[model samples]
Target: MRMCDRAGCDQPGNCPAPKSPNSPERWYFCERHAAEYNSNWNYFEGLDKEEASAREQAERAEGASYRQSSWNAWAGPGDGSRSRDELRALEVLELDPDADFDAVRKAWRSKAKLVHPDVRPGDEAAAKEFQKLQVAYEVLRAAEERRTWKGPEGTF
Candidate 1:
């Protein structure tokens, strides 16, 4: 069974949270503890108002471009079940939201090959696209792994 990370909280830790901003590591907590942990989060803790605003604007702009692409693949098992980042990753790979891991793998490989730095040597644009594809694949792969994982026992 997956026990909560919080000491003494003998509950199923179904909610997964990042250990820190921009970190791949995670902390598993019960629903209540997860809510409590999130309530106190400060996404821009150290940044000044201007810096925070700038960061927010940059993020919005980046997000807007994705929306502008008119790619909404949420039709099937992934309808509202996937995260925003997952949808974005699907868009990056030109895939449908319900695409299985095998499909994702194929899409990523085919697309990645075209923009791979080695294949498109010295092409800055291709390199940038390649990096984006890499991150997208990583996100989808992690999500798929999470979906297929079955806790030790009594965790459900």
Candidate 2:
């Protein structure tokens, strides 16, 4: 087990935290240390309130692509098991909440063909729509793969 990176702490480090803003390096911390670190963490500690707000707004807009899909309209009642983002993917594909893999595949194929960049070259809207569709398909496909995956020979 990895030891917590905090000075003088001796515990299994299960939580990985970034060492600095946007840095690739990470520091591992035990649960207690991780909580302590997060309690004092700030995303815009150095920026003024206006700058921080602007930066936050920009980041939200930049990350809004997947969130803009149809799934936002049909987010399931909060049970905390399924994320809003995952439900958004289902909305993008126009599938029922409990749709099977086959249904997901069919919806993806039909939707993707309409907004393919090649089919609408120079159309920015089409390109963006295609990107959203692609993201949605990938999310659902990955979930399906995880559900159907089998570990080596009866071990799972």
The C-alpha stretches of model 1 lying farther than 4 A from their native spots are 1-76, 153-156
Q: On residues 1-156, what C-alpha lDDT tens digit does candidate 2 reach at each position? A: 799999999899989999988999999999999999999898799999999999999999987764533233233323333456768998988887767668888888898899898888999998998899899988877765654555688323
Clashing pairs in 1: 1-153
lDDT of 2: 0.78
- Residue lDDT tens for model 1, 1-156: 899999999999999999989999999999999999999999999999999999999999888755433333223436566789999999999998778889999999999889999898999999999999999999998877665555577221
Model 2 regions more than 4 Å off:
1-82
The TM-scores of all predictions, comma-separated, are: 0.49, 0.47
- In order, how many clashes per candidate? 1, 0
